[model samples]
Target: MRVDDFDFELPPERIALRPASPRDAARMLVADTRGLRDRVVRELPEILRAGDCLVFNDTRVIPARLEGRRGDAAISATLHKREGPRRWRAFIRNARRLRDGDTIAFGGEVQAVAADRAADGSFALDFAGDEPVEILLERAGSMPLPPYIASRRPTDARDARDYQTMFAREAGAVAAPTAALHFTPELMAELDAAGIAHETLTLHVGAGTFLPVKAEDTDDHVMHAEWGRIDAATADRLNAVRRDGGRVIAVGTTSLRLIESAAGADDVIRPFEGDTDIFITPGYRFRGVDGLMTNFHLPRSTLFMLVSALMGLERMQAVYAHAIAGDYRFYSYGDASLLLPA
Candidate 1:
């Protein structure tokens, strides 16, 4: 389909610069077989069935954004994928100032040598140190805030905590699973008490998630691969949920994509490890997840396409129009939507 079909006009003020004061205070737009309902994150337990299972992405966001200099010219790089203990695949600004052998000195101890420029214009940067790269990033890197938010303001200490979910543990992601940001300990406790089970998996979200679909048609768009993992135990449990007639609710697109990647044609989920570049579009059949809880997405983005696939394109367009006119927030730090397509 033409990419233009997914396009819409969004008012600039609709973008959320800060998250809700209490995470669970964020609005949630619930669209199910019945119809669209405006709700809040705290009311999740009321909307979901007791047998539903919410799968969350526990990948922690790293301070991947870096500012450095090579012979007086400044360079900015956001590390997307970890190629080695010291090597990272990064998207660079002022990339024209760098060559394969060039070394950039990030003040106060972090330095990396640029090597291998990919056709997409990203670079492989190998840090110069014996210490773990995470520690080096601690000294020199800032939170990799989404450009939509960062362009409006600057990242600060508050964002360090705000951008991470309570379930955060394993670290690797350059981007936060925004939908999960609406979840809180209190909300989880309520869900647990309500007998709604939840699980965690990992998907190191990359810089590619922020990239726009420049392709004229959906067939021409290529998704960037992101590393993810699902253990045997999680797979078996998810399968059991389906067998017992429970809904498998994916907490975010990251979890949804990884689960779909590991699912069989018969709808059985299996263990998965490694990269997935699954580009979900309309007409694609979903095998693994029964429902999705995700943030409002950008116009013409792959994420919007994913939701459109779950719910019909016309339905999602109506959903968005309602969200906009109702004053619901948009983007990574925005409000969320619970989509259950029958």
Candidate 2:
């Protein structure tokens, strides 16, 4: 499909500069076969079925944005994916000034050598110390906020707490799984009382998620690989839920993509741990996820394409229109959307 099919004009004011004070206080736009309905995040327990399971990405967002220098030129890097214990693939600004094997010195005594520049302009950064890369990131890096938000305003100390979700445990993701941002301990207790089950999986959301689909056609676009894991125990439970006629609603596109990657042609989910570059566009058959809860996405983004696949192109277009007209927030720190297809 033409990438232009996903285009929509969003007012600049729709972008959320900050998250709602109490995460659960954020607005939610629910779209289903029945119709579109206005709602709030805290009301999720009542909106979903008792037997439905909400799958969440537990991958914690790392302070992946780094500012460093090599000689006279200033360089900024966002570490996207870990290639090894001491190496990562990073998108570089002022990359033209960098060449293979040039050491860039970051704050807190952190340093890395640039090499293996990919055609996409991302470079392999091999760190120069025995200390864990996470330690280096902590000393010199800040939270890798979405470019949309970062461009509008500078990242501050608040984002360190706000960008992380209640479920964050396994750290690796460069980006937060924003849909789960609305969930809180109180909301979890309510969900438990309402008999709405929840589960966790790991999908280290990379900076690539923020990359725009520059390709004119969806067919020409390629998705960056993201590491994820679904152990046997969790897989068995999820399979049982489906076997017993319960819905598995993915809380974010990260969870949904990983679930689909682990599912077989029979629609049975299995244990999986590896990289998935699954590009979900319209016409892709969903195997594991019954519904999705996600933030409003950028126009012409891969995430929008994934949602269009879950629902329908025309349907999602209307859903987004309703959201915009209703003054709903947009992007990473934005209002939520619950999409349940017929």
* Runs off by more than 4 Å, candidate 1: none
Query: How accurate locally is residue 105 in candidate 1, as Cα lDDT from 0 to 100?
Result: 95
- Candidate 2, residue 106: CA error in Å? 0.6
lDDT of 1 by residue, 1-342 (tens): 999999998999999999997999999999998899999999999999988999999999999999999998999999999998799999999999999999999967799999999999999999997989999998999999999999989999999999999989999999999999999889999999998999999999999999999999999999999999999999999999989889999999999999999998988999999999999999999999999999999999999999999998999999999999999999999999999999
* Global CA lDDT computed for model 1: 0.95
Candidate 2, pairs of clashing residues: none
Cα deviation of 142, candidate 1, in Å: 0.4
TM, every model: 0.99, 0.99
Q: Give the TM-score of candidate 2.
A: 0.99
Mind giving the per-residue lDDT tens digits that candidate 2 earns over 1-342?
A: 999999999999999999997999999999987799999999999999888899999999999999999999999999999999899999999999999999999999999999999999999999998999999999999999999999989999999999999999999999999999999999999999998999999999999999999999999999999999999999999988888888999999999999999999999999999999999999999998899999999999999999999999999999999999999999889999999987
Give the least accurate 10-residue stretch of model 1, judged by summed lDDT: 107-116
Residue 191, candidate 1: Cα error in Å is 0.4
Superposed model 2: Cα runs more than 4 Å off:
none
